[model samples]
Target: MIEMTKRIRDLEVSEHLRTLTHERFGTRGRFTLLERASGIGASKWKNFYYKKQEATTEMIAFWIEKYPEDESFLMTGKIPPRKDGYPFGTIPPHVRQTETISDRLNWVIVEWTSPRGAALFEYLEERSKHQIAAEEWKKTVLGEQAPTAAMVEIVCKARPYFAAWITCGSEIDSYDQVDPTCTRSIKTWRSNLLKQLMSAPSEDPEK
Candidate 1:
């Protein structure tokens, strides 16, 4: 029974590898080309497809790293998420925005002590200490040191005002005070963060 189970598993793995190879190369004639691209020897690659030898996690990781866009499919045997127009996975817009905000915040931390000459300069001065205190308090409460989604949302909400102040010398006192449109934008940003957290791929196959 154990040997039977192993044979079944090997067959499944072989079929998956064959399907992936077909999807990638479209023809068996390109098997050598794939072997060259993968940096795995021709005999080893053939053994993998024939189920004469089992593929290791290290081998799978190497392939995934070589083809990052196919990592999801290779690892999970599912279609990868598509971007706006691209067929393969691309970075989501909200993720890009979050990264931009994070970069700007890092710049602010290094380059500026405060929004020194802006009209909301006083508010920034008052809020800076409070922001630090709030983060510290949150760390104490969560007990885990890593920043959570809620923590990221707090920073995300502040990004637009920071950008406006840095770029245009705008006098926005707070995120809420921006405008109805800006308020909607903030809500949308937070919503996207929530959605991303919720939709993250589960590690457990049963899930």
Candidate 2:
């Protein structure tokens, strides 16, 4: 039973990683077992105990950033009524208004504080489409399709912005405010997580 459970947990880890790579990196590939275990905190096989617990904490933080009512606790330092309402400092301070497309709509540009942030943003803007197709070809634990030339183009286009952002300063307090900074420590952890997710394999033979 223990061996059977371990095998099932391992498969779960793989599928999660595969889905994440496909959805986030736009790649269809296989994940090494180690990567799957680390990526989504799916190491346990005792039901949804681990995933549910961790996701709950993360979701709380996510919601705080997404709404205005959540701002009072953040801005005023008042204790929140809900247990989840811990004091979260100002919104990441990474996003700012870029050129305005119209009255209510403006392009928001994110200032990356580290190479990983730049990498992630670039992947989202340029490499994402290719990743979509790449996800379709995922095998057991490796990716078959390499990222395309068009994906490379998208990455290159984002280079200028990244370089410019770095030169001006890594932190963007606002549209005009920039600070030379290093978010490498934070990014390292995030990258490790991604590596895990990108390497997972799926249980569903059809997938």
Candidate 3:
């Protein structure tokens, strides 16, 4: 009976620690950040979270010292006093907003793949009157490297509709309004890339 009670208490404490950790580092928090902050290796942190091993006194002390404001809640699961209109250990709104933008940009560059991209490549080759091999185009769309400025300009001129979606993130209603400046053009391209990513179907066709 005593052993069972001890197991239950340990489980509760583990859960509380996990909750505190998650709250401190939003949903996207990584173990590497914890490793840096607490001086605990990722493997050990993972083991504690998975309940493969208990959190030692030294580890808990390190966490408390690192996040002194959270010590009360970390030890007793009690809510701490709010500071500057934000709760203790919660990520700030501006920081969360920045992370969201980064996530969208990363998704567009890394995760999103579409037939529209392939079509854009075909259009570029035909308009340039130069044969761009399939493998080369694949690398550009996958963001393995950036597409050349000449290629971007040619594509924008040849297929405004596709290029608008690819470069501006939405259909460019008026090409006349598009600034001819190099900086604006690059920004439009990146913005359109993110916009196109948002419109792409998320469900995996293979699944």
Question: Among these predicted structures, which one has the highest TM-score?
Answer: 3
lDDT of 2 by residue, 36-141 (tens): 4233332332222324322233323432433333334433334345323211122232232211111001011223122221233344544455553422212111
Candidate 3 yields a Cα-based lDDT of 0.51
Collision count for each candidate, in order: 0, 9, 4
Q: How much RMSD separates candidate 1 from the native structure?
A: 20.4
- Between prediction 1 and prediction 3, which has the larger TM-score? 3
Candidate 1 lDDT trough over 10 residues, lowest sum:
87-96
Clashes (candidate 2): 9
**What shift in Å separates residue 36 of candidate 1 from its native position after superposition?**
1.3
Model 3, runs deviating above 4 Å: 1-8, 27-29, 81-207
Alpha-carbon shift of residue 54 in model 1 (angstroms): 2.7
lDDT of 1 by residue, 28-107 (tens): 33446456456677677677766677775655766665445455566557765543332112222222122333333333
Which regions of candidate 1 deviate over 4 angstroms? 1-14, 84-207
| lDDT tens digits by residue: candidate 3, 1-207 | 999988776676667777766644334334654675567897887788777987677767876664455666776778655434221123222221223322222223221222233453454466567656544554554335556655556555544433433354432444332222233543565566667789898998899
Best by lDDT: 3
